[model samples]
Target: MAENLPAGWSINGNGAEKSWFRRFEFPEYARLRRFLDGLAELAEATGVHPDNIGFGKDYANVSLTVPSSEEEQARLGDFVSRLDRLFEEN
Candidate 1:
């Protein structure tokens, strides 16, 4: 499934782990904050939140997982696609 993820995203752990994660880097704190704020708004509107969102002055880490069911996998894939587009646009 990791092979199906968008560029810059990858599996967080080895075999049996279902989570995917990506770390986004910014040149400064201001840009990082703005990016996170936009991501938060998207998450709220979509109701598909990351399992974890961590950030420092220059980077943000977003992680997510879908349950084992096929429907959940589809939903997660859509959310991930949205996230990738948001990152690119921002």
Candidate 2:
């Protein structure tokens, strides 16, 4: 799971509860809102939603579960990469 995580993301917990987490910060609320909206759209399009998403006016904390299967791990890696792209685009 550590190998699959993108830069700026960290792993938490152990066993089945293990997850990848990242906190994104924005300069302003509007930018944060746009990022959150894009995240929602990405989740819908990819069907790889985060396990938990918590946000304030200028930051968002995203957590995605670590799947046990190798196939799922690959998908998660792809998803995490796309998420990084989305953040850059926003």
Candidate 3:
């Protein structure tokens, strides 16, 4: 999972579910929340959304998934590039 992360991001194992991982932490929680909300909406509009999106912590954890593997890879590329910019701003 860490290898699949965008540049400048890293992941660690959490005590709970094996899927639990942390990415870039934002200085402003509200801004990050807003960003996550918009990202979710975008995914919905695209018709291929993530399976899970857990927030409230300093970081946003998004589990990307799609019924089709090809579409998932394409969306992942776009999502990764967008996420890298947020990390860059911090």
For this target, which candidate reaches the highest lDDT against the unseen true structure? 2
Q: What lDDT tens digits, residue by residue, belong to model 2 across residues 4-85?
A: 4578999999899989999999999998998888889988988899999999888999999998999888888888888889
The better candidate by lDDT, 1 or 2, is 2
Candidate 2 residue spans exceeding 4 A from truth: none
lDDT for 16 (candidate 1): 51
TM-scores, one per candidate: 0.82, 0.93, 0.55
Pick the winner on TM-score between candidates 1 and 2: 2
Q: Which candidate tops TM-score?
A: 2
Residue-level lDDT of model 1, residues 16-71, one tens digit each, is: 56688999998878878888988888789878799899998899999887467777
Candidate 3 is scored at a TM of 0.55
Ranking by TM-score: 2, 1, 3
Candidate 2 least-lDDT 10 residues: 1-10
Evaluated against the true structure, the overall lDDT of model 2 is 0.89
Deviation in angstroms for 87 in model 2? Answer: 0.8
Tens digit per residue, CA lDDT, model 3, 1-90? 233555553434443332313355667887787677666666666654655767765777765442235566566667656655645553
Model 3 scores worst on lDDT over the 10 consecutive residues at 13-22
What are the lDDT scores of the predictions, listed in order? 0.81, 0.89, 0.56
